[model samples]
Target: MADFTYVSTWRGFVYVAFIIDVFAGYIVGWRVSSSMETTFVLDALEQALWARQPSGTVHHSDKGSQYVSLAYTQRLKEAGLLASTGSTGDSYDNAMAESINGLYKAEVIHRKSWKNRTEVELATLTWVDWYNNRRLLERLGHIPPAEAEKLIMLPSETMIWQPEFTDKTLSRKPGAVQTGFTRHAVSWGVCHPNIYYFHNLTPGWVSFNGEKPEIAIVPQSLHRLIYGPDKRSSPSLDDDLVVNLCTSEHLLVHHPMLEGILLSECERLKQHSLANKLISLFRQFGGTELRLKLVWLCWLDLMTGNSLDDWTKNLKHKSEKDLEQWIIARQGQSEPLTNLMDQYVLMAYRTSVDAAHS
Candidate 1:
């Protein structure tokens, strides 16, 4: 005995319905939508039938227009799946589906905000994957749906062993350049700088310079190849060159390999310079605006310096708090400071949400 579940996300609104098997808490079907369309419910029912392939499984949902639509009823008859609709305004009739919906909102939707249809779609996909594969359902004896399915399929096989392997190798070419470099890397040192030129050497199977010539030896397999490093131990010349060439703006705009190493070094020095400037400005009776601007600039520098999506989201969160605290803690904080902070907080929150949804 199994049940089918249909859930819809209508412009951020979600509706979940299920038909239960009294004997077994098996979920046979589910659907999702961003609208209160009959198609959504129908799709879910169709999917459930596909899942169970049970010749006369009862499909049940609330008395929504979508469920009562001619097309929906026709489809159910065509498939030979029994259709059952709950009585009007009877909460108990659709309790199971409502419970599933409540769980979905509490566990997934309420935790974050979605920006658009695409974002909602992606989030729904992730939620479904988690629910079906990772979630521990108490009804299923605290096992994931997929795991439970496996157990049923291979009851005699007590232990399902999955072999895993790891390859410690970089996925990309050793020295691949970032795309869109021309638009953003004009002031950067290695916009189009040749790695061969940086090394001041002709392409060949040789290690012409270093403390240990043999140790620094260029592997024949790697030499003369555009994206190859001499060996795993040797620095990736192209990536290194890009790092050395990166200015602050360049680093902010381009996602180059080794950018993190270069930006970290740049930031260490920039932080000292900024500290000195701030101290000097404070001594010189700088206005609040100037101090605030400098603070934001430093925050932006740190955010862009990291160049990773997760780090940027974290920086956004920290910056929002930092600005608020800076204004409150500072002695001469102005009214305009509050407005400025509001603008940044909103923007950061939006960006963070977008990044998460993305």
Candidate 2:
């Protein structure tokens, strides 16, 4: 469903169109504009189209002129969507979109006095991120829209919020220029016990995007400690300590594990500012040799002995897309990841007790 609401700005009243998924109550697409022009609404629809690429869906909206516009109807038909408008003066037909608009107004618009379109735009971006990923909905079992989406095996859809708008951005007037690609990426190289785990067991989790050559940053956390939130300069590093990850297999396995402990400990101490040197270098492309060398390292919870930050599973995955489906199907309905690892220990205890009693 789609709807537009007016936002108060010093320049004038800006209009924001929101298109949300009814099933998960996830805001799929949104655009802030100076006017409620047909082009602005089309921009919102474009965002939704590329982000999700849904096949068989209904595009429902109120009996507004924009919704009934010829251009809008043509676009909907081209996308193979059935356009449905509510009967004249029927309020309930577009209640879902109205409900979302009401929340967007009360929560964000009413909270601040805006100066211009840019302020409202930035604020909306932040609020939408939180709303989809963090805000809980009572109807969705108190889970965020993202969690609810995963539970229902909905295809994960993410709108890349670019700092600058591309050719897709609509100006207040017609025939405005908008143009861009998502360029920012981080590569993490992990050290797993079984280097070929992705190749043999969970191949689906890996994508072969040989974008860059192997750039090793041993004790991966070092990258994050430096370039991550806490920026720190590194002293002259020892080549032997870094090369040992290749020559000395033992160091390769244990060194990253030690770093993992340090990272976890940093959070435990809550004095990250004092220990800013430790950071994570956490992005990488899937490859043949790297997969063999990559290791998964973690500090185990004393009670459970299960590797903290590690997911235990026995399965074969074919591609990155397949792994996404697997996660949605198997793990989405399970208890979410928790900061405290004691939950796994309790789970183990209960399973043993149930088995012994049976």
Candidate 3:
């Protein structure tokens, strides 16, 4: 879908609209556009009707001007399909379609940097194919829509097992007990010595046998004492300590000395101010990597520079393309730059020094 959009950019701004079958969740019709004109949506709807040839199906949508247009209405009437528009502000009416748009934004547009419309169109084609044939649908029981439909067409039978349990007896012993409810005897093994026993206490229950149950009971107030609030949710030593140790050892082996380097670099960057020099260096390098490195360098530089203070504080108000342009400009170039990484680092160091004094 992104590729389609990119390719369409060669001509002008374009939007790709599709009519997906609610039952099968397959895109039955889609059309690319250089404009949001009614024709684009109408063409898409026509394609959908022609492909599906549905005798009668509810064509549901929000009260978008395009869908409400005379030409769009005529096409639906001629095809004998019901045109249903949800209330003006009700999102539920067109939630499924909206979700499709959200998915396209998150999974495709968010991830890539496209040069043109042609690229967007091509990417869109690949995305659509994967979505239809490969993507799993939770609504369809974690099966792809096409596969789930196939299964539904051919019914099958299989056996399923379920287990049920009930208490057989309840008895107590003499003063081996501690209280009316003997702490030790209340346990399954102590209460019913002959029967196979199991612990059926609630999650926070405590036991103090010669073999201590591997459960820690920490008071809510004292939670910070052991793990602190942030680390409290982490697995305790009793929970898979061996597995945790093994994972730690494996990580160390796989990336030997990486942690030390990371720590040293962090400490060094913290003490060193290189904000202006970093930004200038980034401007010199100009590219994706250079852009990111510039951002980091800029942070350090800002820490030391009075003039460049809070430069990006209002960045949230900027458009995405504007932000990209700003990043590119900081690198002192734009896309299609060469030897970007080295240039970026050098420029960053220089800029940081300049900004610090300025």
lDDT of each: 0.41, 0.47, 0.42
Clashes of each: 16, 21, 38
* Better lDDT candidate (2, 3): 2
Q: Name the 10 consecutive residues with the lowest summed lDDT in model 1.
A: 349-358
lDDT of 3 by residue, 26-134 (tens): 7767766667788888888877778768744456666677877788777777786656555466554455676666677677866856666667767778887888889
Tell me the lDDT of candidate 3: 0.42
Candidate 1 vs candidate 2: which has greater TM-score? 2
Instruction: Write down the TM-score of every candidate.
Output: 0.37, 0.43, 0.40
Tell me the alpha-carbon RMSD of every candidate: 22.2, 21.2, 26.0
lDDT of 2: 0.47
The runs of at least 3 residues in candidate 3 whose Cα sits more than 4 Å from the true structure, single-residue gaps closed, are 1-12, 155-358
* TM match of model 1 to true structure: 0.37
Q: Using lDDT, give the best candidate's number.
A: 2
